[model samples]
Target: MEIFLQQLINGVTLGSIYGLIAIGYTMVFGIIGMVNFAHGDVFMVSTFIALIAFLALTQILGATSLPFCFIAVLIGAMVLTSLWSYMIERLAYRRLRGSFRLAPLISAIGMSIFLSNLVYVLQGPRNKSMPPLFNDVIQVTQGGGYDVTLSVKQILIVAVTALLLAGFWLLVQKTSLGRAQRACEQDSRMAALLGIDVDRTISLTFVIGAALAAVAGVLYMLYYGVVNSSDGFIPGVKAFTAAVLGGIGSLPGAVLGGLLIGLIETFWSAYFSSDYKDVAAFSILAVTLIFMPSGLFGRPDVEKV
Candidate 1:
């Protein structure tokens, strides 16, 4: 039971991180009706940015205040990745906005390929390790004498995720900008008719989503202490699945979806075998799709043709 609880906590922490990335995907799809395939690569880029910043700062500042340094690097990566997302929208996707849906999908794929190749050329497909930001571990002794261990980094991940999710909830539920976003998602034409800047809203959606992805990247690197240029691929796919699991456009759904996936993966690995983890995950995905095609939180999208 203690082991189960420990695993569940671990799963929740990991799931929250995945939820962050999944929110980015779902937000873009909800508002723009296109999947940004390059998003995962954007995550990879941000992680590299944080890793570089950490290394450089450590060399210059001697790594005394590791927490502050980590926060600063994460913030910088978020801003840069946000800008990159905006650029992707402007350079690649904006042109195909009102065209056939396939147009933007192709553009997304092309951007994904471009980012991957660009990273490979620049970073040379090497796996880079980042120093762990915190070394402190938390241990809890259960009534039955089982020791439960938790890393400071894991706690940080969960805390930061919760804070960010709260902020996101406020942004989406209370802010005027979020209303515009929701309006755009529901009906771009109607949003435009009502004087909303649909294009700018879409760009902002990309920026916000990318920023969250960057945060996820930082947490991921800190959690694993290593990152590769191709690291985002599997996680990205899983995040997308989470997005679909929770409800493609629903914010709460994304979180729920991510946590569910994380739990499933962790339990499968623990009980069965790591070798079959992926198979188990995809099998669950297939079952979910077969039974609940609209996802647990997804409402049927009504289209006016």
Candidate 2:
């Protein structure tokens, strides 16, 4: 039972990260109907940004205050990445609007390849080691000291996830901007007729999604302690799966899906064989499609011919 509980906690932590990235993918898909193949690479860029910030801070400040350095790195990464998100939308995605659906998707794929190659050229093809932001010791007193441990990385993951979730909830539930966003998603033409700027709302959606991706990226780097340019692919695909599993376009769905996937992956690895983890997740997904294609919270769209 103790082992089960430990695995459960591990699953939730990992799931939260997946959920964060998934929300971005889902939101973009919901609002703009774009899959954003490059979303994962955006997370990769954020990780590199955080790493670069830490290195620069340590060099200039002599590493006197490690905690302060962490805060600075996170803040710097968020700011620049948020800007990067805005720019990508403005420069690339914005142009493809109203074009053939395949056009945007192909463009997104092109962007992904371009960004990955750019990072490879700039940082080299090898994985880079991330600096430790949390050095505190956490000793679990349960399970007979099976040597269970926690660290600042876990706390950062949870705290940052919580902050982003709360902010998202407030944005969707309480803000006029969010209302405009929902209007756009429900029907772009109607939203445009209602005086909402569809283009601007779409832009905001990408910015918010990218910013969340950046946050997830930073957390991932802290958790794993290393990152490579190709890091985003699997997680990005998994996050998209989580979004669909929870119910595409549903805010709460993203969170629920993320946690569920996280738990399944962790426990499957712990109790079963690690090699079967992907198989288990995909199997569940296939079953879900067969049994509940709309997902846990997805609402069906009705169209009149």
Alpha carbon lDDT of each predicted model: 0.87, 0.84
Candidate 1 C-alpha error for residue 106, in Å: 2.1
- lDDT tens per residue, model 2, 228-252: 9888777877787888899888878
Candidate 1 residue 202 Cα shift, in angstroms, is: 0.3
Q: In candidate 1, how many clashes are counted?
A: 0
What is the Cα root-mean-square deviation between model 2 and the actual structure? 2.0
Worst lDDT window (10 residues) for model 1?
A: 138-147
Which residue pairs overlap in candidate 2's backbone? none
RMSD vs true structure, all candidates: 1.7, 2.0
lDDT of 1 by residue, 1-305 (tens): 78787889889988998899999999998988888888888888888888888887788767768778878888988999999899999999999988998999899888988887788889888889866668798886546778788888888999999998899899988999999999999889999999999999999999999999999989988898898877867888888888889988888998999999988888888878989977876776677777876788888877689
- Cα deviation at 87, candidate 2, in Å, is 2.7
User: Which lDDT value does model 1 have at 178?
Assistant: 93
Off by over 4 Å in 2: 61-63, 143-147
Cα error of candidate 2 at position 151, Å: 2.7
10 residues in a row with least lDDT, candidate 2: 140-149
lDDT at position 292, candidate 2: 78
